[model samples]
Target chain A: MRRNSPLVPYLFVLPLICLLAFVFGLSLIRLVEFSFKQVRGIDGPWIGLRNYELVLGQPLFWESVIHNLKLFLTIPVMVMVALVLALLLYERLPGWRIHRTILFLPYILAIPIIAVVMKEMFQFSGPVNAVLTALSLDFMVLDWIGSADVALWTVMGLIVWRETALGVILFLSRLMALDESLIEAARLDGASWRQRAWHVLIPQMRGVIEFFVVISAITMLSAVFAYVYVIGGGRGGPGTATMVIELYIFNALIRTSLPGIAAAVSVLLFAVSLLLIWALFRVRRREEA
Target chain B: MTTTARRSPTGAGMMDRRRLLQAGAGLGALTLTGGLAGRALAQTPTLDMWWWGEQELPGLQAYLDKAIAAFTEAQVTPMLQDTAVVISQFQTAAAAGEPPDLQYLWNGIYHMESVWLGYLAHLDGLMDDGLLAASNHGPLSRFDGHVWRMGWYPLPMPWYYNKDLFDKAGLNADAPPATWDELLAACEALKTAGVEPFGGGVQDGYWAEWYITHGLSQNLDSVGDAVNLFIGDLDFREPRYHQHWVKLQELRDAGFLNKDMASLGLYPGIDLCVNGQLGICSSIGTRLPADAKTTNGRIGCMVLPVFGQGALAGRPVVDMQGMGIAAGSEAKEAAASFLNFLNQPAQLASFWEATGWIPAASGFDDSVITDASVKDLWTRWGKGDPITNITNLMPGQFYEQAAIPTGQNIITAGMSGEEAGELAARVAQEWRDFNPDLVEKYQQWASELSAG
Candidate 1:
């Protein structure tokens, strides 16, 4: 093939695709196979879809799915917060660099590190409630990480606080690369900041927003394990209140010694994740077109 | 806007020929050293031991390090496992046919699942028989007439009350509550005295587990009865089986548990009693040495007050941690020798001297114990008719999904005792469904235990 041909580009990337297939592909195959078996130690006799039947039939599985759905509520809040923050910074507010760094600091820190600090801070008699009690806001003080009804919400708050930073950075990067001329034209046409953000900049930045939403959807589904692990005291408790799908799968595999059940849940999560990745690709392809 | 692709000269030379040559030289040196080390190590077997304890018992690492050094039979390399990964890591390694020779085994179902999986070697023939018997590995370590693990240390499950708080409440400091009504009366007195009466930190769910360890056994005929509940031979919906939750609920409803109890962890909850902030909480034998010092020996230990009419009521509960040789291990004899060495009278004494806690072996000299509080614990829970920690017999599924959660729900979610029973029954069914293979094994074991 000619060096300039598209086939040459494909050849250049073929090795990585092969490597990825050998690495992740083999495990993915094993994971599906394990899902069909009643796995004990490393392997076990095949039980067909019995693992799936049990996992899906369990109420805890549905509870986990519901919790993940509840987390999906954060994306709208995150998008609004990130858009406003990014737009505000797009104007190059004073000390913007320092402000950006400070805003991004939570994302830079490991989830467990921040989650531990937050767990302590929000404890019933910890600083957050101590301040509330001191200020005569005793009714407002709930068992932040201990009460089942409030623990999942508390986990969501932490997720939003840390995860929104990624959105802010993503949106800000897109905003920075935008056509400033369009915003200036809108300003000249008597468009207010909000109007410019809504009608001009945001409309043009549709691709990044979709990208952020889909990524957040994926995260809330499969990646809130650390937040719940630390905040809910590591067992997704206060009575499984913060039990998301990832923690459910984790408890199945590691804690409960139900590897087949864990694998079944993993397959379900993997399928959902693939859909989100596919959505991510479509958005990217549309933007490129 | 214009963009610059900034690439440094050093960046372009990321894996240059000189660097490759240096890497090759380093690899050659490492290979040479590894060859020499392998030859030197061939005279004696190298036993890999993956253990866990330093998190729960401080100085355990020090004691183990000392023991490993003194163990002359093999070159034992110890890897301290994180609290969460201990079971999974061993099982995973064993499954892969490359398990460490020695593994720290938690009693009952914790290691029994590994036993059932055929990952652990039978300790009966491998280790010293008398020493193994003296180690008190507990009944859960045996199945199909085989022993799986050798006991390492004892965890006596006792409820601690603040003697100072009892006095402050005009209650007898010497006589802790022995009946359910007396416990209620004491809680009332403590409340009147402006002290939080009946809880410790439960945020980590261990306090909840330890509660069941002492509480549920109060209503069981034998440790095997606990197994029957999980294997579907019995149900948690029984009034007697779940009355422990009802008692816990009574405490919650009576405004007896600490207001902050739901937010604290197991150790910190124990601290509430030791520090005189709360009147009572669940505690362990290993904690008594330090806790006794913290409260100036004012901490009183007792079994959870009797409520049920079961045969096991009021018996002291002691859970033991143990060790086993992995079935896949090539150095099984060496591993067994190390476990045997640890249980010997001298090493057991060293364990106590280093960890400030009692070893599981009965051969250890108790005269060396100076702390009055720890001494009392050792005498009462360690000596006479002690029922094994029944929670140790719980299936891991029931433990994480039902047992821990049920206690948590009762305390915090306002879940009634009856509701907790329903939840337990449901989770038990779920466990049976998820693990049909294990259910048959558990049923057989349950029958053998119940008959015993």
Candidate 2:
């Protein structure tokens, strides 16, 4: 058993490569194929680019893309809050370990569980409104998940609340692994705590920050289905107000039985996500340079 | 002597032979056990049936279990999925050529969609034995000159009002409103009495469609006219359809609806009606018993008030929930047998008694439904010209992209009726344009219906 043998390493990775190629690669290929053709029950005559044209022509599809972009707005807020919290914890605050565990608790909980709890709390007559009414802020007691004007923001708030935990854990690990000498040198140079954090710690943690932002943007684009589905009550309403691209794809596939259009939208979504990630990396490279 | 025996070559060979025989016997026993298990599985016929919303019906499971048990040749395995996703799952399975033996086909879009896609087997041959009544093979169950599916039950949407609330508002409980003006007066009176006139939620978008369809169906001349409107042959921008929304807006403006109507779902809205917070709630027949129970017999149902002179004046919107044999099913005979057994009068009677759903098969003794409200429902269903829900007749996309959203806009977004009607017309036109093949197919079907 020569450890450095090229054949041996290739053999070791063969199973995983085969599995990925079979499961994901083939499915993607099939999806693209289906996108080009009209799909009825199981199969239909080929109708090139018609599905894509129809999908792109839909007002609802653009509405969903806008909704996804609105959701993406929460990523910066999430990163900022998580970074502050992680930096504070890096100072060894009282009960730091317990605080860190508590902060990460929501990330470990099941999404549906969190979604259900949040949905109940945000109902028009639920505890959140009740509390507002009690506090003499009755005017502020708006329909959190019901009103078209506010529902997307309410969903964004929920995402920020649940997703901040992952951000905190990511930033915390990076902060802990930072060179202490940099911070110490800044402090010895008579820099205040804020100055040290702003100049020394943040600049060092740029890579993790970029990673978190890209990951969050991708999640916002693709993985917010359950949240929107549950909170929007599956129709992505109060009249398509909370509809995201993923839910649109789901509706096209399941509800409308338009698999061709769904596949077309899925391909578009993949393209958008890739473009976003690529843009993020390009920005990071420029900043580094 | 033991030591000498151990060293003997003949003894050693004999022991070796015995060990080999024992190992062979063990292997043979294992193989025999596995073979028997596999054979047992192969011999027992398994029929996969997909259904949804059975949990809401109290006795459906037991009835199905008994029916399945009675079929000695085949065992039915029911897959209960969320109603929202059942059609999608069926389509996926059918496309893969692995569909269940039987699938629940909701009368309007589900049945028509599956039939159009050639995913359902024509069930006309199954009815040749007269297991299902000839009367049951009418429009709801038959399409394209074939009975594509057998009906399970037929439920019609009607306005169920809390009699107690009506009485409290000083309105006649016995004589529910018969005209739009009268209904508005009742709403005003109920509002003045500190009671909400209607309990329905538009948040789910279905309540809006249900309300609009209920209104429009009454304004249509006939079921055919309604179907024509749904298929884009009749313009939705017509004043008749537009007026339905205008009247709905009037209801909203006058504060006759539940305060949180836009935020509540169907069950919650019905709960408000049942708990006596509102005077009226519109729902299908299946929810009536529960309404009656909650109101302690204070609940009564009526056809929606007529807004104008239309063809379907006294008709209620009746829709069917039925089962169809999958086109790809290998056990078609078994599936048809189960459907026939379920359609028998005795079974229908049992189902009606337990669930209060009107049996699809005709000639079932009506005496089984002894509840007064249920009896009233049955009578109404019989007397009314049976028009299908407009939501059911339209393309599924129309309901999602146009009807629901337009209704919501009218109710919540202050969208004018004219605007809503125009939007709806656009959606219908787009659907027809986008799916030219389906539109052509529906036109052919409609022509055949007229010829028949």
Candidate 3:
């Protein structure tokens, strides 16, 4: 009970540790248990691995996994755009504060809100196509969100637009903290803006860039549900063209009443996310070193 | 002149301690007299009702609020559920042994899964036989000689055609196309008149479901035939089973579908017909009042034109939303009593007045409807020999994976009707593989529905 005792500190934090265990620990155990059973109405007879087998056998599950993989393409685009925008803003360009707010507006707004707006804009007869037709570019007008071939790409565009904002904020913070003397020395050496960026700014921003890329990878994998849900008509539709692993799990649990299948998929997604988290830790450790 | 009235206890914030003491003493005296009422008001059976409808059918909450105040059978506390959680929330709570006494029920497999899980009480003994029958609780609500739901409001599935567009195309608006070929001809004429024809929004995927609701039944001999497809006794690959999608493909191939149909939602798609931008779109009865007014009685409702050789073809389709007692409820009798009370004549009329939509009870008086268009719709789709919506019988797996995506793919992505059938069959097989436990229940349900 003494203030200086290590046991006292452990006691002080024990409640929080126990709370975390109860909140997350207990549910995680049940989730893994459910994954091994045929769950109905919160409990069911255990039929080990049947749910996982069924999930793996279904082509729809594979389709969803492929779609999630497709979404990974957004990270590189997000990184490049965010880095360029951050460098421009870092130069203290005219009205950089206003420009920063404008760039970050998509991130500030909720995903569903921006997604709804994007859905409206990208509809076949929506304003975007109307404008395209109004211009001399009639052939460029395509069914943006309606066609199965184009819907996922449209979703990718939305992901990049919104998620790059976080990268911009992160890279700009890192850029501002960089040694200005190094950039000034590059300028005195007659390096161009692109050269200075590639040689001076980006090399120093490796840690923040890696962190942003890792975080965005996680978002693309598990956090794009709202975008796909809103744009793909709440069922990952226009023929499941936008079906992602998150939506696949959602359909299994809520729509199809197959909680066991949902749990199995959730476990897989959790495992994949854990790997990404490990990679993130390695990056963090190296950065600290 | 009225200073005493201003000083009355009923006036806002005007009560003094003396008046408070007097009011308390009055309440105490009332309680003493209330002993003759057989039970203290506090001891009255409390029923918890979790419901959902106001999101789809506005003013439903107001109607239920008024009815709850009017009923004397029990103390009812109604909670309006979110649309997405109506089933899962009830099932989860029921599994945890704390379900609401009464729960809202969507038709067919939506509630049947809960029934199979033993989460809902059968209404056969709890509800009056005559009243329950008159409630039109549909074949899907019954299984193993027990009924599990009491019908609340009916959604008469109708296809709306723009009369103005029809007349503009030199076709008789009074006589809508009654066969598949006639429908194609009508669409051709409408297109010639520069009007989009024969499709609605499928962007939200509900349009696709409604399409199946009307179209699939065109080839079904009974509601059970639809269930048989999911149970694996029947197959969507059979030409007759998927003829409906072929008809949709025919429309698409002929350019009868609106250019933007793939990007619109069910309601906005219906708005195309109502606003005269398109020729025909699938719709529900609840929208007729506003739509009829918007079009000044120029909107026409009809069954989808027939194509397949089946007993159920050319009949109107109506889907009902209902209520059921939770199996875990402690106050089952009170909940049953409240349900019976809702089916009474006055409550049915109040339902009509509050929602301006027809109650599902056969006892509902149709004369209260004044709009000629609405009356026509009710007379044809509601009062005529109507088939229950077969789309309601689809297992949730089939519905989410096959039913919705098939129509969407055919319309938006150039998927052939045969391809749709293949996809549907595959999804049905997948559903069976995923839910082996529910398959036998569906088989038994199919047999009962077929027998009825």
Model 2 RMSD, rounded to 1 decimal: 5.1
Better structure of 1 and 2 per lDDT: 1
How well does candidate 3 match the true structure, expressed as C-alpha RMSD? 4.4
Candidate 3 residue B196 Cα shift, in angstroms, is 0.4
Share of true Cα-Cα contacts across chains kept by each model? 0.82, 0.46, 0.74
Off by over 4 Å in 2: A1-8, A284-289, B1-45, B134-138, B353-358, B382-385, B449-452
Q: Write the per-residue lDDT of candidate 1 for residues B1-452, one digit (tens) a residue.
A: 33456556678736878889999999999999999988877878899999999888888999989988998889999999988889999999999999999999998888988888889999999999998899888888889998888988988888899999999999999999999999999999999999999999888998888888888888888878999999878889999989999999999999999988878888888887888899988888888888889889999998888998889999998889988899999988888888889988889888887888888888989999888898889899998778888888888888999998999999999999999999999999988877878889998889878877
Q: Write the per-residue lDDT of candidate 3 for residues B1-452, one digit (tens) a residue.
A: 77865655666777779999999999999988887575667778999999999988998999999999998878899999987789999999999999999999999989999999999999989888888899998888988899999999999999999999999999999999999999999999999999998888999899899888888888888889998998889999999989999999999999999998888888888888999999998998999999999989999998899898888999998888999999999989889999999999999999988998999998988888899999998898888899998888888888889988999999999999999999999999988888888989999999999988
- Per-residue CA lDDT of candidate 1, range A59-106, in tens? 899998999999999999999998899999888989998988998999
Find the 10 residues in a row with the least total lDDT in model 3 chain A.
A279-288
Which model scores highest in lDDT?
3
Sort all candidates by DockQ, best to worst.
Answer: 3, 1, 2
Clash pairs of candidate 1? B201-B269
Q: What is candidate 2's lDDT per residue for A17-96, written digit by digit as tens?
A: 99999999999988898899788865677999998888888788899989988887899899999999999999999999
> What is the two-chain DockQ of model 2?
0.48
